[model samples]
Target: MEADKYVVVMNSEEQYSLWPADRAVPAGWAVQTEPNNKEDCLDYINRHWTDMTPASLRKG
Candidate 1:
């Protein structure tokens, strides 16, 4: 069996998501880190994406 390729994505809102590495990324979102397997992608997001608020809404 072949493993699936996954990439970590971030939005203007600072939200993190896992997407397929081969597919086209959606507008308003960009790749935040290198691609990895599903587990790695999830782990990275869990550790890094501590805040769920958008950049504009977060209090400084």
Candidate 2:
């Protein structure tokens, strides 16, 4: 990881800090959400996350 590769997966509206396995944690943390709706969930992450995940990579 060449820095800026930390991502956190969570489902709430709170913040926490963990030792990132790769890059430095962002302003707070990467907030992944499971919202009531699919778009809502995607929008939540899109709003708070950096577009660093490569478009061609498989997320799983």
Give RMSD to native, each candidate.
2.4, 13.5
Give the clashing residue pairs of candidate 2, or none: none
Q: Please, what's the RMSD in Å of model 2?
A: 13.5
What digit string (tens of lDDT, one per residue) describes model 1 on residues 1-52? 4448989999878888998998899998999878789999999999999977
Local accuracy of candidate 2 as per-residue lDDT tens digits, 1-60: 333233345422343222333444455345453223444444555665454544335344
Worst 10 residues of 1 by lDDT: 51-60
Looking at candidate 2, the ten consecutive residues that score lowest on lDDT are: 11-20
Instruction: Look at candidate 2 and tell me the lDDT of residue 46.
Output: 63
**lDDT of all the models against the reference?**
0.88, 0.41
Model 1, C-alpha of 51: deviation from truth (Å)? 1.4
Q: How displaced is residue 53 in candidate 1, in Å?
A: 2.1
